[model samples]
Target chain A: MSARPAAIATLLDLPKPYLLFLGDTREPGYAKTAFGLRDWAPELCIGEFALTEDTVSTGLKRLSPAAAYAQGARAVVIGVANYGGVILPSWLDSLVEALASGLDIISGMHSPLSSVPALREAADRHGRRLIDVRKPPASIPVATGARRTGRRLLTVGTDCALGKKYTALSLTREFAARGVDAEFRATGQTGILIAGRGIPMDAVVADFEAGAAELLSPDAAADHWDIIEGQGSLFHPAFAAVSLGLLHGSQPDIVVVCHQPGRTTMSGLPDYPVPSLEDTIDMTLRLGRRTNPSIRCAGISLNTAHLDEAERRQAFDIAERSLGLPAADPMRPGAALDALVDSCLRAN
Target chain B: MSARPAAIATLLDLPKPYLLFLGDTREPGYAKTAFGLRDWAPELCIGEFALTEDTVSTGLKRLSPAAAYAQGARAVVIGVANYGGVILPSWLDSLVEALASGLDIISGMHSPLSSVPALREAADRHGRRLIDVRKPPASIPVATGARRTGRRLLTVGTDCALGKKYTALSLTREFAARGVDAEFRATGQTGILIAGRGIPMDAVVADFEAGAAELLSPDAAADHWDIIEGQGSLFHPAFAAVSLGLLHGSQPDIVVVCHQPGRTTMSGLPDYPVPSLEDTIDMTLRLGRRTNPSIRCAGISLNTAHLDEAERRQAFDIAERSLGLPAADPMRPGAALDALVDSCLRAN
Candidate 1:
């Protein structure tokens, strides 16, 4: 990571006190960025903006670009990760208005803000910066497979957009609460925006994916824990490479398999069915052993948000009973989460 | 692959015939590009050039830039793939002289020829194109895991820089000789230079690795066989991601495991040992089944260049007996190679 000076300089340099932009998406999954910032870094978020009234909300105050600027927001962050990460033409006027209102625009999309001529012209005329967190570092060395010191807990999933990030973030917090040195390592756009610095795993060149992952979580104290947020899934045909690279490079001592009980099909891919929890844990442990021979599954983090309280309880009960591992939802903090964290910390 | 017009335009459009430039290196392994061209596309190669007189020879007639141009060579291709695919500073003068002598420069190096000021200036002055075949296609889709209609036989290996490409090329030739509809799909710089068209697997964005692989060998006739040249090894910590991605995307029904018997360590990675042939085949088949459920190993392609006639025979015998698969050196064509090809074609 140190080899990339340009990426390092901008890694944690995004303008704060932000206005979140939920770009006309009704699907709450796409607006995970907005909700993530609201939940993780509430102090930095001044307000939220959206194209339509029916769009998903972060439960924050709604403010126009001018109003957000007047309220002391320094930047307007696009808080939506739509399919293909494209900047739609319908959202261009609002982004331009944000620039004219004296706020810079920050994005996590694969398509750069500069690619849109209107946004680029507006930013240029207003002298506002356009930041893209999805851009990878300029230089990344190939992973040497050389082991690094420190304990790491990575959250892998049966499919993409599950609870990997949330699980990692919660575990890191719980570790710190128990007087352990812990760092949350981000590997995607939302996680990077929340953590302020991280390698965009998906954006890196295929050869450098593992190298970038290695740089993302470097060596630290023996007792320190690097809780890494995983990306994609081993069963995910489109992104298995990214997931495998992150898994090998992170070299996690403990892994938490994230799953949503009733996910019949993979996210965004209706053709492929979600793999079973047994297969997920088995594959994760088997592939993970390549880098960390002692790698073990700590537990399962169920995304039971769509289920009722009774269903959530049944899901946890079934998972723990079948896998012989702790099962919990990070969003519902209690003895379950504590047990999951305990199992992770007890591993080493 | 068709979505990337720029890459498609330059895919098989290199100026020919080529004058192979072996930059000062005496290692035959580093000069694979030269040897590959001389062996596979001898008609397209006019002669070989090198900075040092003692450098490894492709056995083609030696020629200077002017001499090569006079003999109807249209381009000077950098025929060496050194550590990191770097263009050495010492080789700049010879490349400049080639451009000055009215020959375009075709490079397969990771470092783009346009990156060097001197080479760029020389090419610009001489109006010669600096084509980098290692550059990936512009637009690649994510792999959908939906099976394409065709038969595929991929050449994987126990380690990098073995005989994956050579085995693949030989198999394609053998299949065609048998009156089968077959094609050689290249994935690396050397293979691309030899095949004249390919997606640079390592150069692709990590998220799109499988996508690029899918595009490279798109749906063909049901009986058509794509002999894909594999990249890194699954046991290779630095490159396992690329290997896995290619495996999943290619979705091959048959795989030929390539290995060098005496190699103790991974290519350029001294810390890691090369996995045994059994482990290599086992892991490859296990992971490859994710996309192609009927995936099976056809044989092992042994790189027995370092061994004498008796040693080579012993190595092949040991490999075949131990793994229960045909083992042969593609360089030493015989019944062994024919058996390997027969096994691959019979897999459908």
Candidate 2:
């Protein structure tokens, strides 16, 4: 029999030096992954490029999928925008070319790349690996209302993509720097790829969404904080179920409200305006108590990226005064990292 | 070749006179399924009984699952309580016996009978059918936050089994008696079995829980009201996700809050006290606006079954006075049914 390739345990450990593929997809999710890895985990992401007939800047350089391996890339992380409908028949050949070149392939979409017969055959022929991060794992137990004994910090957002993952990471980093035993539990594909393991909360069946969270933040030693990445906003009509489920499942003792100062309306729904930061904090605290009665709004993870230096300072000041919480961009220096960490530690 | 059986388009049109199976499992879910049918659609329920070696009363009479067809039972509806574990080996034998006797099988448990090899084989051998009511249908589209035009009424509750189902059914009956085209849309197994078709909201995956509601209450004529049954209480630690999901998914114009006067605390979590009627209404109205901004809490459905006649009347008086909404035991005449109808019609 021919030699068999070892099963890849975690994408984080995958021979990265990753070729980020943003193929003609301008969805914020794709852009975020490209920019997030480039900014935060640049050491893992070797090159940023896309393979598409349409010559768009994509804010990244262009490289054919066939040329990925030659460009010092060990794996290709495909961040295509469209998860709905059929995968373009046109993209398969390029993918097959990449597989033939011995590049491991990864995707974070509803359509399983492994389900495509030709793609599967191509990977099998070249002894390469294909990972679909959105495929929910088997035998996830139904969430029992077991009161976990560790302190948990969950980063909830005003809407999707308001820097929940980023805030969670920042808090985890801060906690680690302070010599605290803290962990960042990822809930999305991008988080999973960067952090090595996490449940794709959206991909999980609704009934098990909470169960996934319960399992993700397994009981840690007391005083250790699990900074869990939260999903959608509770006010988002399209995705509030996931948001609420994550909130309840995490059973967090400390909730960090993540909001972008410039988000005037609910994402994608112009008719629905975003709730005021105060309203979000009030609602989140109330809802969070349904599970964890002691849950409190520890601080505000303000995303003021769209504002100028002066405007960001003003917005942060308003958030701190109006919401009566420490507000700051976790990524920037002189942010309210001290207040957030102290609040969590004090709660325990 | 052997002759093939005819396809079953809808169980609603199947020979009525269903045999209800309790199976020595006296879980609240089973008793509700049996009693719900006995009260609302008695014409369809030919018999109600249990089958078990334990010989417990199960609060219902005993019958052999093997003896189902002999009792003129066209179908055996299994509402066993233990859906958590591997279905007892004893259950499969009885289920197989029913299938062998040419009785169709219907179950509303997390542990699906269709997954049993012996039962499937028996059904195949006898040309009988197996129906798992909790099995979600295919291609349930993600909720788009699309505005659905039509009047919808949802009965929310302070806790599970606090008369949400009873309230919805009562309102539908009251509406029809008044010559309005109102429908009670079931979101659980008992309601589904009673009404013949509905989305089992709790069984649905977390992400698509709202989508199930959207599809269940399709846009009706402006005059028609789809009174949808609600699930778990928002304050329930074990199940708030389902409650919040249903609330958002239904996008109801009118909401009726259901409460049991005797419940001093939440169902399982004794530490978590049930909110007062006023607080429940306020929180519900606030959260409901996340989806439908114009949502109104039209009335309170009080379940005062544990109270004496005078106590129930007094409880209703207290609820109405405190909530400042029409409050009543919907089962009783001269309650708040007329006021609830007026609220929905007025909202329209």
RMSD, model 2, all Cα superposed?
A: 7.4
For candidate 1, state the interface root-mean-square deviation in angstroms to 1 decimal.
Answer: 5.6
Query: What's the residue-level lDDT of A258 in candidate 1?
Result: 95
Model 1 CA deviation exceeding 4 Å by range? A1-32, A46-75, A80-104, A116-128, A268-271, B1-32, B46-75, B80-104, B116-128
Best by DockQ: 1
lDDT of 1 by residue, B102-167 (tens): 999989876788888999999999998898987886768788888999899998999998888888
lDDT of 1 at B275: 89
> Model 2 over residues B106-206: C-alpha lDDT tens digits?
77765567677888788889998877777666556566677787788999888887889888998898889989889889887778888867777776666
How close to the true structure is residue A79 of candidate 1, measured as C-alpha lDDT? 92
How does chain B score by TM in each prediction? 0.82, 0.80
Can you write out model 2's per-residue Cα lDDT over A105-170, one digit (the tens) per residue?
887765677778998899999999888777666666566667897789999988888899999999
Candidate 1 has which clashing residue pairs, if any?
none
How well does each candidate reproduce the native contacts, as fnat? 0.65, 0.38
What are the DockQ scores of the candidates, in order?
0.47, 0.24
